[model samples]
Target: MLSPESAEIVRATLPVVGASLDTITTRFYTSMFTERPDLLDGLFNRGNQANGEQRRALAGSIAGFAKALLDHPEERPDRLLSRIAHKHTAVGVTDDQYVIVHKYLFGAIADVLGEAATPDVIAAWDEVYWLMGGALIALEARIYAQVGADDGRTWRQWRVVERREETPDVVSFLLRPIGDDPVPPARPGQYVSVRVRMPDGVHQLRQYSLSGTGEEGLRRITVKRVRGGEGAPEGEVSTLLYDTVRPGDELTLSAPFGDVVLEDGDAPLVFASAGIGCTPITAMLEHLVATGSRRRVLLLHADTSPADHALRQDMERLADALPAAERIFWYEADAPQGARTGRMDLTGVQIPRNAVAYMCGPLPFMRDVRGRLRAAGVAARDIHYEVFGPDLWLGEDS
Candidate 1:
């Protein structure tokens, strides 16, 4: 619990600090990589100055974390801990890393604030950092312990047992860990970090949603290698994983981590995904059928062409299995084939009035989906999203 006076100081400083978020985050990252550049191996992506929504989310999440602490220390954000856990896994952040980040981050804040950061004010922020970081660490530890357990019921790891290109650009890998025979469990909407040692010996990390249906022992992730796509630099790990890595390769992985898995188990679930972002929704479709989620479910996937429509056979199989269930709605932005022949618009279309919505993909796709969902009168809370890069949705420097 924060002291009443301490909390008051936080409240007073909130506006000014929030306004200066960019400065602090920029300084923090600079300080971090400068001191411990080696940690960049597999952790920080090789880039600077966030672009697109990725940049926005990174800045937003950092500022949001602080704002949440200062503003609502008593109520506590339910998804906050889970969000941090997801971030930890996404970036491969560890216990020691958090300490380093917080140390420099707060130090930078002090420098920026100058006289405003009185000793008392500094102490209050300390409590806030520890409290928030403690919550994140505790949740992270619990998630990690799922691995390295004797019981097959818990988490499991797998080696890159095989690799195959299903299409020219679409590649899939078979993971078979030396540990547990049965794969560790993963929620439908969760994702895993695939860590690869770079040519320069810098371990690089990238996240891919598990394509196979919660297959713990033999998990598979199919990635559509974007050749210089989406600001994708000479993808440090993704390239090697695609071009060089062979079967029997070893890579460290975190357990499934995400907050936007299937929810509203009783209500109808609507899945809208675009491009490669279809991975998670595809898993959810299989999960819904496998778990016998009787609630009506609709899958709306947007792909550019017939070849780009991933898991068509598997989705068809799942849909066929659940013949009596809801429905499978695939919206293809087929450029080459010109199938649907138009952009997706739920305004006058297939999205059910009462369905809960989950969407993923590029920024434009998400923005379009959100507009359509909102236009369809979906409640704000009922719609959720998962983003890549950085935590960027909280606030901007308005």
Candidate 2:
């Protein structure tokens, strides 16, 4: 916990860091990798660094922590720290390295603020950082302890068990935990990080949500390699996971974690997903059906081409399985082979007027989908979306 005065300093300083995020993040990572080369192996994506989303994520986390601690002091930080811990876990971040991040970030604050950053202000930020970092440190400590508990044999080494081409660019990796020990169960709609050595690009980290129900005997993730721009390659991690990473290869990973899910409600539930954004949504449906929920459900998905559609056969299975749930698929390709042709049309797709909308996708796609949902007269409180990156594409300023 931080003093209110210290929290105020943090609230004000976060705006500074948020505005000039790239500088702080560049300094932060530069310090981290230069000081500790091991992190470069699988904790970052140089290609994704060009857009500076990761940097923004770091900045946002700091800002959010200050706001949450000040706004909700009695709150335990699990709801806040667990998400970041999962992300860090995906990238193999340890508690020691988290401390290193704090050292450089505070140093960056001094450098960037120069004379304006007083000792009191610095002290304030120190409190804020620790409150947030301590939350993450504690969470990571528990996760690592869980990993270490069973003689270091539990979940220590992960091997690729099966790989399937779900869509053209999107591939699903079915990973089976192999060891003398047992594999712990993972919830649906959570993600795991995969590590690969990229010669063209630096060693990178990317996350994919489990594409199917967990009891399927293997954990799966669907990946769509963003290309052309500065984000990801045509293959990116996909090329590495598909071509380079063979079965029986060892990859370190964090346990499954995410809070994004179907909330309890009698009102109609609307799930909207675009591109490869369907991964978690798909899992939600599987979980929903497996649990025998009778709530009215609507699934709306958008994709560029038929080749890029995810889980066509399984979606068909879900459609048949869930009597109250109806799925809507929209393809943007010219030759279109689905129910709806072209991009997601908020005009054409009629969501229940009172339905709670859960959405996910690329930034532009989300912007349009949200705009359309609003245009279609959906209430603001009902529209929920998650931006895959660090960027805030949700309520308020978004």
Candidate 3:
């Protein structure tokens, strides 16, 4: 809980701080990266930085945390904190990094706000920052302990056993430990960060969803080659994974971490996805099949065409294996027989009253499905979603 004095100050200056967050974040990254270039090697994603998504995400988080503190001072922002902690742990973020972030962030605030950033304002925001950071540090510590990487080390080498192309732009790699050491188990819908050396000799990292169930000693990750457009650079890690890495190659991966996962229950499940977002949903379905679960499952998917659907066959196979599973597929072109054309719509679909829907896709698609599900009597709490990259969902939803 915030000190009453600080809370009052925060509530009073929140509008000014919120309005200047973008500028503060931009200056923060610019100044921090200029002084600490090594952070760009593997810790920070250059692609996200180049396009300003990282700055935007940081701004959203800070503003959201402050707003939440003012709105519900009696409670903590567990959802926001959990999501951030999971992402940080996936990227091997450590406790000390919080200090570095605090330094540059507040410095940027002081610089941007100038005379307006009085000592009271600074102290109040500092309290908010440390509170958020402290919560993340505690959660991350627990995650590391649970994963048995309590030494703050999270990276491990896994050799690629198979590389199979699922689509023209998507590929699936099956990996296994080089030795007989027991592999850590990952829940369905989790992701692992893969770090690779770029042509410039600097390591870059990218997170890919664990696209398959933990099948004995093996794990799977699906990668979609990211194309550059609209002034954004192409994805360095993904491009290298596609063109250079192959079977027999060893890759560095962080322990699987993500807040969204298939809950252990017999509740009716609806798996909705579009494009490459189908990976995690496929993993959940595979888990259900592996466990011989008899739960009612509804599979909903959308894509540009049948050829463009990365895991169409596997998705269909898993759904077929389930006794009470039903499927509805939408495609913009080349709609398969018995499948609908154009975008997905729930107007005529029969969604079970007790269904818990898990959706992963573009922001627009997930937002649309989320709205439709709510309109059809599904509670907001029952509809969970996953974003492939920086989660722009909560900020926009808020």
Candidate 4:
């Protein structure tokens, strides 16, 4: 809980700080990168930086955390913190980096706020920052311990045993550990970070959801080549993986770490996804099939077309194997025999009663589906989602 004096200051200054977060975050990234360019080489995603997504996400998170503290003084935002901590652990973020971030972040704040950033103001916000940071540090420490990554050595070499083309733009890699180190236990809906050296010799990191069962010994990640359009730059790591790194090549992978894992329950499951977001959903389905789950499953997906769907066959085959599973797909063009045409519309679709839904896709798509699911009587707490990149929708529901 925040101290009384600090809370009053934060409450009074939140509006100003929140409004300028974008500028502050931008300045923070610029100044930090100017001094510590090495952070961009391996830790930060240069593509996200170039596109401004990382800056925006940081701004949103800061503003959101402050608002949550002020709005609910009695409780900490564990959900928000857990989401961020998982992502940080996936990228091998250590406790020391929080201090580095604090220095640059506060520097940017002071630089932007100018005269208004008094010592009292800075100290209050500093308390807020450390409160958020401390919670994250503790959560990440527990996660690291659970994954046996407490030593900060999160990366491991894995040999690609098989590479298969899933779609025109997507490929799947079946990987096995290169050493005798036991594979860390993975849960359905979790993801692993893939760190690869770019052509320039600087390593870049990207997270890909496990597209197969979470069983030990082997793992699979499906990659979709991110075609840069609409002012976005092409994904360097994805493009590199797509063009090169064939079977027999070794790639560095982190232990699977994600907060949005499949929950064990007997409730009906609703798995909804679009494009490459289907990876983790497919992994969950594989787990259910492997365990012979008899729970009712409703799988909904949307894509440009059946040809563009990365795991179309796998989805169909898995759903078919399940005794009580139904599959519905939407395509923008070339609707198949039983699938619907046009964008995803759940207006008349029958959502199973008491269904727990999991979604992974673009933000707008997820937001729309979430609203419809709520209208269809699924509780807010029952809806789960995963974003492939930095979470721009951090506090949307809250």
Candidate 5:
């Protein structure tokens, strides 16, 4: 809770601070990285930084947290905080790092705000920062404890046992622990962070969903090589994983962490995806088949074409394994015979009355599907979504 004095100060300055958050965060990252280059080695995502997604996400989160505090003084933004905590824990963020962030962030705030950042204003914002930071630190500690991870020793060696090409651009890697320690258990929709040293001597990391049954002893992750166009640079880690890493190669990976997992229920389920977004949805289906779920499941997907769809065979096999599952597909290319030919349309599709829908895909695709689902009488809360990168879908009321 904020003190009355501080609350008034924050409420007064939020407009200005929010307006300048982009500049503040950009300056924060630039100056912080200039001094602490080690953070870029394996901790921070260099690609997200170069593309400005990280900056936007950081700015949005700070502004969002502040707005939530002012809007609901008695409540905390657990949803926003929990999502961030999971991502931070996945990358082995430690408590001390928060202090470093505070120093640089406040300096950037002062730099951007100029003389308006008076002592009282600075202190009020400082309190807000610590409130958020403390909450994240506490949540992250609990998550680390839940996952049984050492404070800073989160990385483990995994050897690739098999690599299969799912599509021309997507591949799946099967990995086994290099040591005798058993692989940690993970939920169906969780993801693991894979860290690798690029040719330039910088260590880079990327998160790939656990695309198979989250079983013990082995793990599988699907990677889609990102070929950049229209000003976006090629994904460094993904390109390396595609062209260099192979069976018998050793890689470093973090323990699984993601909030969007298959919940225990008998309610009907709607699993939807587009392009490579099918990874987590595939995992969810694999879990359902493993458990012999008799619940009605609607499996929907969209892609450029059958030839471009990753894990197409796996999807069909899993859907067939479920006695009550219905599979639907949409392709950009001409529909072959009975299949639909255009983008995903749920216009005539019959969704279960009480189904819980989970979707992962491009932001635009997810937004469109979400609107249609809501119009079809599905509660907004019942429709869950996951974005692959920095959540550009930040301001949406999802």
Candidate 6:
């Protein structure tokens, strides 16, 4: 809980701080990375930084945490914190990093605010920062312990056993643990961070969803070669894996860490995905099939074309194995016989009542589909979503 005095101060200055968060965060990253260049080598994604998504995500989180503290003074925002904690643990973030971050972050805050950043104001926001940071540290510690990564070690060596091309731009790598260390159990819909040394001799990390169940000492991850468009640079780690990684090659992988997991229940399940977002959903479907689940399942997907959809055959095969499953797909071109044409439209589709939905895809597609699902009577709380990269959807109004 925030101290009463700090709460009053935060409530008063939230508007100013919120309004200037982008500037404050940009300055924070600029100054921090200038001094701590080592952080960029493996800890932070340069692509996210170059495209400004990382800064935006940081701004959103800080503002959101502050707002939540003021709105719900009696409770901490565990949901928000949990999501962040999982991501932090995935990247092997440690407790001491918070202090390093605090130094530059508050420095930026003070620099940006100038005379407006009085001691009382700084103290108040400091309380907010530590409150958020402390909660995350505690949550991350618990997660590390649960995953048997309490030794402050998150990465393990895994050798690629097989590689299969799923689409023109997508490939799947099946990996097996290379050491005697027990592989941490991965729940369906979880992801692992793959760390690779770039040609520049600096290590970079990217998280890919476990596309297949990690069973029998094997795990699978699907990678899509991200083509640069607009102003964003192409994905460095993905392209490297897609073009070079093959059988018998070893890769560094983090223990599975993700907040979105397939809930275990017999209730109706709705899995919606688009393009490469099908990875996690595919894992969940595989789990369901492996467990011989008889629950009603509805799989909805969208893609540019049938050939462009990764794991298209796997999705069809898994759905076919389920007794009460229906698959619907939409393509902009080359729609299959049973699939729909153009973009996904749920106008005439039947959605089971009291269904729990899991969605992954582009923000626009998820937003539109989420609205349709809400209109079809699925509760907002039942509609869980996973974003592939920096979750810009965090503080957005649903």
Ranking by lDDT: 6, 4, 5, 3, 2, 1
Segments in model 3 whose C-alpha atoms lie over 4 Å from true places: 396-398
- List runs of model 4 lying over 4 Å from the truth: 214-216
Worst 10 residues of 6 by lDDT: 389-398
Clashing pairs in 4: none
Candidate lDDT values, in order: 0.67, 0.68, 0.89, 0.92, 0.89, 0.92
Q: Flag clash pairs in model 3.
A: none
True-structure RMSD, every candidate: 4.0, 3.8, 1.2, 1.1, 1.4, 1.1
Q: Considering lDDT, which of the candidate structures 5 and 6 is the better prediction for this target?
A: 6
Q: Model 6, range 248-300, lDDT digits (tens) per residue?
A: 99999999999999998978999999999999999999999999999999999
Assess candidate 3 and give its lDDT.
0.89
**Candidate 2 clashing pairs, residues 3+ apart or interchain:** none
Please give the distance, in angstroms, between residue 182's alpha carbon in candidate 4 and its true position after superposition. 0.9
Per-residue C-alpha lDDT of model 5 across residues 1-398, encoded as one tens digit per residue: 88889999999999999999999999999999999999999899999999999999888888888888888899998878887888898888999999999999999999999999999999999999999999999999988888788775678999898999998899999988888875668898999999898899998888999999434578899999999999999988898899988999999999899888899898899988999999999999999999899989999999999989999899999999999999999999956665688999999998889789999999889988988888878888788787787876654354
lDDT of 6: 0.92
The backbone clash count of each candidate, in order, is 10, 0, 0, 0, 0, 0
Record all residue pairs in model 1 with backbone atoms less than 3 Å apart, i.e. clashing. Answer: 42-203, 56-392, 57-391, 57-392, 58-390, 58-391, 158-177, 159-176, 183-216, 183-217
Query: Candidate 4 at residue 282, lDDT?
Result: 94
Tens digits of lDDT, candidate 2, 314-397 = 766875688798877888775345468877776756677687787778888877877887777778768766557564532122
Local lDDT at 136 for model 2: 78
Give candidate 2's total backbone clashes: 0
Model 2's TM-score against the true structure: 0.82
Better of 2 and 6 by TM-score: 6
Position 343, candidate 4: lDDT = 85
